[model samples]
Target: MSRNIYAFLAIILLLLQNCSGQKTDTKFYDKDFKWSIQIPKDFTKVSAKEWAEKQQKGENALEETTGEEVINEAKTIFVFKTDDMNYFEANYQPFDINIDGDYRENNRNVNHALYQTFRDNMPNARIDTLSSTEKIDSLFFYKYETKIYLPNNQILDIIMYSKLFDKKEFTVNIMFTDPKCGKEMIDAWKNSKFEK
Candidate 1:
């Protein structure tokens, strides 16, 4: 089959795997906290080890995709923790980045303006809002839902956000998307755990 079809099937299988078993103890690590959560049987546990293995195998099998491909396949959710401030800085910093067709060259100009607008609006406070963007991994990405008639009309939904409880400097990124299966994906992220 095609790569997109393979991705979609893998996602479905992962979801089913997550939903089939009893609640499992999930663990994740951050800079300051080693967290554990009881995950329901409906969300697949994409362990760091497994993710690494998949990457090594050259199999984009976890179902996370941006741009117009999401509409044809199931949406994917990814949860990973990074203690490296430099990585987060690179991700959040404003630069002349382009994804799909959305562009944010200036901190003041752009269509969605998430990075710029949020920083300007809440200089020192934790900020959260939902908006559309045409960028992910330096490529274009749609917002909560896919754009109409786009070749890959997939929408990435940010379900939850939590800063480091004690450190107050670290951030947790939890995002998921499934055309009509949003609730299932969100529940998985909500019940996720982290290990320090």
Candidate 2:
């Protein structure tokens, strides 16, 4: 199996595990990470510890990814999902982007690598080029949508928004088990504020 699929499955399972519901509008803030996002009153927000416990209690499908270690690093930002629990409204995480020489060129190379990896893993995968290069507030992002055909003919729509800042990258991921939430997810992504 491709490592990208393993990484992607790990992230999806991490999001789906040990999810609990919460009321009241809340602002998710991580002081050390210097990032915050507004989670609506109807949504639910939980801790990464809870998800870790859930993964440990289960069969751990992520571990079967052929030696791809699942690193549950107490993620500062947990997933924010809709009230119905059908889709993820918004998720934020910061990563150390390995941009070796030129930032833009390296970033493009990284994207290309991921694209090829995903295609290699899932031959039936349908990818759409939403925005190869989109700028927002002086930030350049490569955005795209992909439809992965799962077992039993179920399809998952994932819209990935990634930005390279200095040597770090911040990803704002929105997923829909049902494709109808695409517009709402895009709106939420646009309204989200990321403080560097």
Which candidate number would show the highest lDDT if scored against the true structure? 2
Residues 1-196, candidate 1, lDDT per residue (tens digit)? 1122222122222322221222234443333334333333334445544433333222332223312222222122333222111000001111122322222222112213333332433345443445444332232332322111212443333322222123121222333444334454344434545542
For residues 1-196, write the lDDT of model 2, one tens digit per residue. 1112222333445534446656547666655436566554565655455544543532245444233454442232455566332344323233443423554554454455445545654567565434466664455676755666665576667666665544444555566665555556566556655565
Give per-model TM-scores. 0.30, 0.60
The prediction achieving the highest TM-score against the true structure is 2
TM-score, candidate 1, is 0.30
Candidate 2: global Cα-lDDT? 0.50
TM-score of model 2 (CA atoms):
0.60
10 residues in a row with least lDDT, candidate 1:
83-92
lDDT of each: 0.29, 0.50
Q: Which ten residues in a row have the lowest lDDT in candidate 2?
A: 1-10
Stretches of model 1 off by over 4 angstroms after superposition: 1-36, 53-150, 168-170, 179-181, 188-196
